[model samples]
Target: MLGIKEIEAIIPHRHPFLLIDCVEELEPGVRAVGYKCVTFHEDFFRGHFPQEPVMPGVLIIEALAQVGAVSILSVEENKGKVAYFGGINSAKFRRKVVPGDRLRLECEIIKQKGPVGIGRATATVDGKVAVTAELTFMIG
Candidate 1:
């Protein structure tokens, strides 16, 4: 398992932008499973909705990408590098993610060629899927 500090070492996100809290499982350059503890204090809640706050779908995808980043950047050769989003494909939001949700994020490297790769990513809440996407990234 990896915490925010370890995750910070692998990816270039911080504070409000760093969506993941802990990584429960990781296979360097292959796959990762992580968690995001949603809370009412999130800044987005103020504008996303005043009465009924919903975790934005784009942020869910970003959380999944961060997990994918951990999987790729943890590899020895990719250390100190950054993973940039090349594209997002087949992104779907199945349910609304709200405060107090513990989002489970998982990603697997489905394809790769040189510095570019594709990840099959998903985010779930209480075993129910909230979002899924195929993320393309480039290691820099």
Candidate 2:
């Protein structure tokens, strides 16, 4: 398990923009499972909807990407590098994620060649999928 500090060591993301709160499971260069504790205080909630706070779907995809980053960046040779989004394919938003939801992020590197790779990613709340995507990344 990795807290925010250790996650920061692998990925370059800070508070407010750093959507992931903790990593529950990680396999360097392969997969990672992380969490985001959604709260009413989220900055996006202010503009996303004041009366009804819903975590943005794009941000949910970003959270999935961040988890995938931890998996790839933790590799010894890739340490200190950045994983830039190459593309996002087949992204789908299935359910609404609101404040007080503990969003679970799961990502597995399903394909890789050289510095480019693809991950099958998913985000869930209470075991119900909220979002999913095939994310491509370029390690630089």
lDDT of 1: 0.96
**Any runs in candidate 2 off by more than 4 Å, and if so which?**
none
TM per model? Answer: 0.99, 0.99
lDDT of 1 at 131: 96
Q: How much does candidate 1 score in TM-score?
A: 0.99
Q: Give the per-residue lDDT digits (tens) of candidate 2, residues 68-113.
A: 9999999999999999999999999999999999999999999999
Q: Which residue pairs come into collision in candidate 2? A: none
In candidate 1, list every pair of residues with a backbone clash. none
Model 2 lDDT at residue 121: 100
